[model samples]
Target: MPNKLEQLKKMTVVVADTGDIEAIKKYQPQDCTTNPSLILKAAGLPGYQNLLGEAKGWIKSGESADDVIDKLTVSIGTELTKIVPGYVSTEVDARLSFDKDAALARARHLIKLYEANGVGRERILIKLASTWEGIQAAEELKKDDIRSNMTLIFGLEQAIACAQAGAYLISPFVGRITDWYKKSTGTKDYPVDEDPGIQSVREIYRHFKAHGYETIIMGASFRSAAQVEALAGCDRLTVSPQLLGELEADEGNLKRQLTPTMGSDKEDKVSEAEYRWSLAEDAMAGEKLNEGIRSFHQDTQKLKDLLTGDQAQEKRAVAQTGA
Candidate 1:
């Protein structure tokens, strides 16, 4: 019998949710994804020292720390493109989540940087938070053939809005949703089939397939291998290295849990007003979305600080040598 990871690949596209090149080589997932947090973690890895040095070199060339961060992001993404056969998701600045124009401009710049590095736009998915402004930015980018992966999705309304905006892909956070529910209900464990996270993805999957929306649904932010196993037949799943290793070791019989089903209701395009109202009503969605953005933004700032510290050290070394 094949391992659970191999079995999962038969029904869904497995995506590595880390920035570790060594892990990507070992698992050989179909795609790879990175956000500010993942990139920050990857920056400290021994293998990425050259990329970090190059980014610092950009600072010596008069690029600001922010610009160097962007360059480093694309540099890391360029390396991932060589390993993954499918798309690599590079995120926009999380602080720009609510600013449509700035987010759009940043996404375009990231794509341009990737192209400059010889990785075409086709191999990249510009990741954005699932804010209203972010959705609008994605809508306009799609007009120019730039695909986007809408991340931090917590509610079905967000998924519907992204689908209506013609987003190339949407990543519904499974573990985060479960985390919210578990805290609220004071429950420690949930049966695999009854897991709130798994149920959330199943709802989104059914809605998309039933309504004939072309946008792909990719489940992200898993907590356990059981959560991953529950959504085995999803369109795609972006999993962390720890969970991937667990799945690789388990030789359990994985069954197809989610499949397309026809629905009697007609599809409705979500308006901005409706989208905002839906999120406002759903406390979990609103809070989680805000929290996710803040967390990513914090990591972005931390990355900048790490680079700035390096820059300062280099300057002191030069001054001491001259003296």
Candidate 2:
């Protein structure tokens, strides 16, 4: 019998949710996604030392710190593309999450960098936070043929907004939602049927399918293979190598739980005010969404520290150049 992983591949597109190129090669996922957290983790490994050295070399030249970081992002993404056979989602700076114009400008800039590296927009997904502004930015980028993956999404509001704005894809985080519920309810376990994370993705998947939206539903941030199995028929699932391995090792039956037929229940489109109010009312989504943003923001700053080391030395060098 084929492993559950193989069964899953028959139902949905499996994506590697990490920055580690070796992991992508090992799993051979159709696509891969990365964030500041994953990139920072990858930068620390000996395998990525050369990449870090390359990024640091930009500093000795005339590149500004932000430019160097952007270059490094493209460099890393370029390497990932060599491994993964499909799209690679590289994020804009999380700090620009709430600024529509800034997010749009940076996303366009990221696409240009990818194109300059000989990877066309077809293979690149410019990831933005799923704030209202981020969704708006995605709407504009769509007009230019640059696709987007809205990340850090937590509620129906965020999901609806992304779909309404014509985002290319939206990553509705699953593990983080389950984690929030477990902590809030003081429960250590949930049947896959009752898991909040799984249910959240299922609801979003149902809604999107019901409405015939073009935006793809990619369930992300899984804590277990069970959650992955639960959303077996989602458009795509970006999972860590750890869970991918677990699925590979288990030759268990995996059923398709979110097919188009299951999503046939219809509803009206939500207004902007109602969207915000619905999201605010969902306490779990609100807390986790905020936490995800802060966490990503912190990881991005850490990546900045990694890319441009020795802040005092940098300051001294800048003062000495005095040009």
Candidate 3:
């Protein structure tokens, strides 16, 4: 009999969702993903200092900060692409989510930047937040032959919209939703499979698969080994290093529960009107979606500050020398 790992290997693609090069190289995930948060974490790590230094050199060359940000982001993405045999998802700035035209423009620019660095569009997935506007931007980019990963997804409405908009993939955040439930309930104990967050992704996965929607569902932001184990047969699950290590270490029973061929029967599907009403009722999703974008936008501003601060420091040093 094949081990549990073997069954999992056959069922779904495993992806490492971190910016840690060492973790990625150690596990050998089929694909990798990085967001501003992960990149910021990586930038602060000693092991990844060389990467930041390289970006700094580019900055010193008088490259515009925006160009440097693109170069730095693509550099990390290129490394991940080389390590993983499949695509690496790199995100556009969240600040652009509401501006469809600017978002589309930025997506094209990022693709061209990747191409210039010898990374083809086929090996890259441009990640966009799953806002209606973001979906519209992705639709336009898809027409231009650029693929996208719709991320920060929380609701079925967002999932359906992404599929209808022709997204190549959707990253539903499983762990964050679980965190929300835990905080609200003030409980530490919950069955892994029955977790609200895990269930959310499973529902999205089943909906996409059963409806013959071509958009691939990738469960992201897992918090525990149980969350990863529960979604064993998902199309793909972008797991963090801590959870991945736990899965690799445990020799316990791991079952394949979320198979496409054997789905749990769901209630009547949401009508368009129901979905809109549900969105209005679910205050958490509405608040979180906006909060997530605001948080990402803030991180982007921090990154810009880092780049601009370095330049200003250098200018001051030169002025002092001349004086």
Candidate 4:
């Protein structure tokens, strides 16, 4: 029998959730998505050093520091595009999550960098947080035909906002939600169907089909193969390299748990007031969304700092002086 991973590809689009080139080559996912954390991880790896050096060298050029950061991000995504046939997701700085204008400007600049390097706008998906402001920014960008991936989503409210904004895709993280529930309930184990993250994505998926929303639901941030297995029929699922490896090795009968036909299938129409209050009421989603933004922002600043002011020379001088 073929691997379950092969079977999964038949039901949904599989996206690689890491920036590791070797792993991406091994699994060969249709799309690749990276955040500041993953980019920082890659910056420390051996083969990625040249790219880091290149980014460093571009510092203090005619462009502003922010523009240089945007180019580095596009450069990575452009490299990813060479390997994957589908669009690569390049994230706007997480610090701009709640800033609509800043997010739009940064997203537009990232697309331009890709275009200048011969990759068209269609080959890229600008990733933004699923904040009300971010969703609004995505709505405006869509008018210019710049598709976006609204990520860091946790609740139905964020999902609805993204769909209403016409986001190209929204990744509701199943594993992170499961983590939140585990910590809150103090339970370490959950049945595949009962996993909060999986259930959340399943609910979102069913809601999308029932309501005829075109925004794609790509379940992401899975902790185990079971969560991924439980969301087999989602529009897409971005898997970590580790989970992808497990799925590639496991050959059991992987049954589809989610379909458009399942769930209450309610088309929920939410007002801005309702969206904000509902998100605030949901403890798990509220905390996680804020945490995700902070984590990403912290890593983004780290990446920016990596390129500032003669990194190598300063380090070498420090080494020579033994200070």
lDDT of 4: 0.85
Please give, for residues 1-323, the per-residue lDDT of candidate 1 as tens digits.
99999999999999999999999999999999999889888888888999988886777788898789999999999999999999999999999999999999999999999989999999999999999999999999999899999999998889999999999999999999999999999999899888888888988898899889899999999999999989989999999999999999999899988877635264567889989997899989999999999989877877776776666754543333211
Best by lDDT: 1
Model 4 agreement with the true structure over 1-323: per-residue lDDT tens digits: 87999989999899999888899999999999998888777666676778878887888555565677787778788888999999899999988998999999989988888999999999989899888889999999999999999998898888988898799999998888999999999998999888888878877887788788899999999988888998898889999999999999999888877777764646488778877897799999989998999988877666666667557744543333211
**Considering TM-score, which of the candidate structures 1 and 4 is the better prediction for this target?**
1
**Count: clashes, candidate 1:** 0
Segments in model 2 whose C-alpha atoms lie over 4 Å from true places: 264-266, 311-323
RMSD (CA, Å), candidate 1 to true, equals 5.1
Model 3 per-residue lDDT tens digits across residues 1-323 = 54444456678898888878899888788999988777766666677668778777777788877778777888888777878899899899888888888888888888988898899999999999887779888888888889999998887778887888889999988877877778888979678867888888888877777777889999998777777778888999898888777777666666787877544454435445655566578765666677788877766555655656566754443333211
By lDDT: ranked, best first: 1, 4, 2, 3
Among the numbered candidates, top TM-score falls to: 1
How does each model score on lDDT? 0.90, 0.84, 0.79, 0.85
RMSD of 4: 4.0
Candidate number with the higher lDDT (3 or 4) = 4
Q: State in Å the error of residue 4, model 3.
A: 5.4
Q: Give the Å shift of residue 194 in candidate 3.
A: 2.7
Poorest 10 consecutive residues by lDDT, candidate 2 = 314-323
Predicted structure 3: lDDT: 0.79
Location of the lowest summed lDDT over 10 successive residues in candidate 3: 314-323
